[model samples]
Target: MTTPAAPARRVPEAVHRRRWVILGVLMLSLLIVVLDNSILNVAIKTISTPAPTGLGATQSELEWAINSYTLVFAGLLFTAGLLGDRLGRKKVLIGGLAVFGIGSALAAFSGSPAELIGFRAVMGLGAAFVMPATLAVLMNVFERDEQPKAIGIWTGGVGLAIAIGPITGGVLLDHFWWGSVFLVNVPIVLFAVALMLWLVPDSRDPKPGRIDPLGVVLSVTGLVLLVYGIIKGGRLADFTDATVLSTVGAGLAVLAVFVVVEKRSDHPSIDVTYFRSKVFSAAIAAVALVFFALMGVTFFAVFYIQSVRGYSPLDTGLLLLPLAATQMIFAPRARLLVDRFGHRATTTGGLVMLAATLAAFALLDADTPIWFLEVVFFLMGTGMAHVMTPVSVVIMQALPREKAGSASALSNTFRQVGGALGIAVLGSVLSAAYRTDIEDELGLLPPGARHAAGESIEATLAAADRLGARGEALVGEAGDAFLHAMHVTALWGAGVAVAGAIVTALFLPGRTPASEGGDRNQELAPAAER
Candidate 1:
């Protein structure tokens, strides 16, 4: 007689207990991803020296090298989350690290601009896989009470990457070739892959569902076009006159279709119902805006300090230390503040400080002191600390346990998307404004002199001939013009933050944790009674 086979054994308790050990492994690996981004910022000077391409490669291409990885990352992450849920997060997570390491190796060996750009896109695909699985696994390993602290510890990697990228890049460039930056990821990924196999308990969702592949296609395409349109992409990437308008319109239509499809699907990947939570919605909006403004500063600050203020890469890194150094305290500690003060009060207060900082920055000049800039930005980072954890806790607490993976995926999606678009939007805005200001300032001189002054920013900056007399006067006017444009961007950023504050105040429930916990416990009572 055939006997029924024993049920498959689950992971042993010892194996399960070893799970948190993977966090340290993953942090070092993920830091490579984050560090690759800002690391290049400081090394811009060094990289340009050895390029085979003509000097001052088009602005769009420069933007691409930095943004391509993030765009792919933001674009593919939702799909990646679904993949993890359906197949297995552990499998995807390790695979992602492998892919990312390969891309980094390619980037390090890149011989031309095209090769570098291609490698960056490959890295993005790898990142697409890495991010979602990391969080989902962390949530899996820790209990609800313990999860936030785990996430906080995990987020500390971001702080470490941000503070250290420039410093590390500066030091590396001082010693080795620019490629050394990309090569650094190799060892970290190797170590993490080994640790992951040993310490991470591989698990998948016990209950699985269909993932809408068509919906994912539509969503990713739509985001690409939306990002392209906002950035005003050059025709070189196939953004021809016809393609630009048509691609943009098609993108919007596809996104609308995605929403409709998701609403109709029996097993939709994105939880359309989550929009009902005002707290979740408001907190997400805040995350997007804050990252947008923060990236704006980071994207251009290195260029401005080096190009205008004549700072070295090391000096630029040193200047940013304040933002990163003070922020580590804010990342985890801010949760306690959020618990004490309402999300509405802390969020509002934080945004106000961000607004004030940006507005104050509108007054900077060619002769403006670095110490002043440093002081203002230090306050900016300090205040932002108050906003981050509170918004995060609100979102996490509201999510049903079953849907937490999807929910956090969506929140992080907005953060990365906002960051990518912010670079494009803010950069384009500054370029247009700079051109206008230069033209008007040059109008004060003779027609011949006007053309010279109205030339591209490089031409004007390199024209040391303008340092005194008429040129000096024009420089002064140009500085004021730049400041004025920055003021408008700052105001836009502030307005978004203020809108978030209002939304939070309106939608958030006022119950204390004790009451909320009691309510949750009550909900569980009915099932137990059954």
Candidate 2:
């Protein structure tokens, strides 16, 4: 008569209380990191305009201001996770906050576009450190039963950040100089740093292995080159140009080699086998595409609301509230829909809604009712709520407990990569279409003015303002051309959403009642051992 095994003991009550407090701090840190990713959106116009009011930056330079941060953040995420594992996560987190604060302060005082871009990259470095450390610390503190709930809260913070960032930035831009956008981060960073030091516990892998130096080099180099090539191809170079072709080809080749190298490494930074699971692959793809659609729409829509519709920065941010508000409201409830309809149904349905919304946006013009855009924005945000949160839960379930930090970083990296690509490809299409439509209208202007106007919508608007009554007529023409370009770009975004929907439906595994419990392990296992 063998006795039944004793039930596992629960974490101590004191530890449990501490863990919840720590989680709150983690959420605060995550909120700041995620908010910085998008806070620049509503301020783009102010930052790039001619001096006295702005830096007088070029269009490509403006793109770099945003892309440089995302690119570096995405590129270093995995490597930074490994470093956090090897070093103390709390140490890394505190250090990251300091770096971010310093970068923000420096950015506020930047005199040139180059200085701002460089400081932005520094902030990205700090973000890379902060992001993985927060998740890793959360995983360490929470019990298995608690982790999923914790992750839900953490994911909800991202939605909240998205909801708040633009409006906050818009308000600041209304009253303050463009540099105030970066400056706002300084105080928040200080608060997070203080709270984190007091409440967060230090954690790291006791048996952390050697850092994969080659993997670090390859991932950073490959992603930077690929993104640079795509942006250049869209804005500055033809697809067939030697610089574009060679850079893109080189990036692809290096990434392929990186995959091969990782597969063979005894202690790889990213385990290639994770992608073998359909849940992981499909979830990653769906989330990435969701971000792709979101960023692509924002890339053009912000300009439309500002330049064409003549809304102020504050009003443009308010116009976007429907999208952010719907997303924030729906995010916490996403899991219920997943359980009711299953992952495949919920995710695919959301993608279809996104596609439909994008298609509707393609029909919009300068005079389309504001109410119509509000409806579209709400639907788009709702669809994203379904796609992002559910897929994140699926991914969290798919990863082993020990790999939490790396897996979280991986998910965010793909999302950032997708966003960067969307901007590049869609921005390129908009540029090409706008150039064709605007050139005919610009024939009446002097060559210098024509060249400047052809470069960007902002430039065209500025040129129009200089020409008095003729400029007003030119503004009308420019708006028309911009609307046409926007329509075509919206169609392209719709196609991407459709593809995501089809992929989610066909490739993601169907959910069953038992399968959900069976998918996750009951105990932690080190990824290196696996």
Candidate 3:
């Protein structure tokens, strides 16, 4: 005879009552972090312009400004997640918000590109704590049955940030200095901190593991080295350079050592064994690959819309509305698709759709209709919404509720690292391609200026402006070269998305009776229990 059915999992009365409110607070926290990145997308062109009006940042320096934040954020996330689980999520969240606000202020007043990059790293440090803590807190407040829906709404917050950030940045850039985009975070942070203290409850792991300082150091060092190598390769347009090869090799070596150390440690920063579960591994991989493709494409798209197409910052922000709008519309409803079609089918379909849209970029030229881009952005958002929500549910639910911080950290770590690599690698590809096509035309410029002019479309235009009427042919050639580079980069992004679709289809779980009940806790369960 079977034993009596186990009692249903219990969520505390206070938590149950205020779960939605807590989610709202968490979303507010998430909004500021995500909003900063989206706003920066529209401002990339402006940041590259000459001084007084802009920073006159080179393409590589601009990449560093972006990558510096991403690298630090990705590297510190696992440690921050552990801290949230051990020290208390509410404390970590409040502290993170404060730090982020401070960083934003510092970033706003940065005097140069170098200062901006440093300040952005400070922002990333705070964000590392903020992102995982938000998800970990949500997992605690909501019960298993309601998690997917809660997570869907939570993911939709990203859509909302995407919607608001560019438009807000556009208005500020139109009326005020570039610093206004960053300064705007201060008031919002103040409001979120007050709401969080009043409405959110503190939570932590009942049995927390020791902090692995060595692992943290290794991870950060490796990522920084790796990303630096990639960016350097792009700057020189030569991956075969000794510096690039040596740094990249060393980074891989350090990361390999990190994995080995984590495997042997008693209180590891990351439980390497959790990756044995094919479903868990696949979901994490999918997150990484998708972000890699998307972030890289986005880095180029901003320049395309502004520099190549001659659109104002305000127009670029308005044009991007369809991407964010579609995500807001589809993200909350994505769980319905998962329920009907299961994770594998839904995610696979989404990846295919994403790949198709990336490939569609190859069809775009300087003269491509704006409406075509709107359609592509709409479909791209729809695809992203479907992929993100279902996989998030899978990854979060795979481990016990108490380990939510680790789970969330693992998911976000891969996503951020993927985006960082995408921007570096794909940005490099675009740079290399454009440099090759534009180098010949640079003969019109002075000897020293030719090298600078070939760096990017913006640089070429800046050089053209200095040359007056004689630069007209160079201007036309620069636009054509950039389009070719963009097309090449788009295809590379599409190929990466297709690889993600394959991994999702092959390894992510199909529909199962216990899918919503957290399924089998095969790999992540404690050793004693296992």
The per-candidate count of clashes, in order, stands at 0, 0, 0
Stretch of 10 with least lDDT, candidate 1: 521-530
The best candidate by lDDT is 3
TM-score of 3: 0.96
Q: Which order, best to worst by TM-score?
A: 3, 2, 1
Where is model 3 more than 4 Å wrong at Cα?
Answer: 1-9, 513-530
- Superposition error at 104 for model 1 (Å): 1.7
Best by TM-score: 3
- For candidate 3, write residues 377-417 as lDDT tens digits: 99999999999998898898788889899999999999999
lDDT of each: 0.68, 0.80, 0.90
* lDDT (Cα, tens digit) per residue for candidate 1, span 1-530: 99999554343556447656767766766687788886877866555443442223234455666677777787677777777776788788888889999999998878766777788889988887888777777766666666666666666667778789888887877677778888888888888888778777665666655677887777778877766665553222233457666767877888898899988888775666666555667777777777877776666566566656778777888888777666666777765665576567777777777767766666665678899989976887776776676666656556544444565667677778778777766655665555566675565456765544442344454343445565666555555555555655555555655665566667554435754754642343232223
Model 2 misplaced stretches (Cα beyond 4 Å): 1-12, 514-530
For each candidate in turn, the TM-score is 0.84, 0.93, 0.96
Poorest lDDT segment (10 consecutive residues) of candidate 3 = 521-530
User: Is candidate 1 or 3 superior in TM-score?
Assistant: 3
- Per-residue lDDT tens digits of candidate 2, residues 1-530? 99999656344456567897888899889888877756788878887688878887766677777777777777777777778878888998899888888888888888999998899889888888888889888887887766666776777777788778888888988898988988999999999999987878777777665678898789878877887787677664266778988999999899999899999998776777777766678888998888887887888888889888889888888888888888778877887777677778989999999999988878788889999999999999899888887787677656565666777777888887788778777777777678778888887678876765776788787777777787778888888998998999899999999999998998765555745544433311222134
What lDDT is reached at residue 221 by model 2?
85
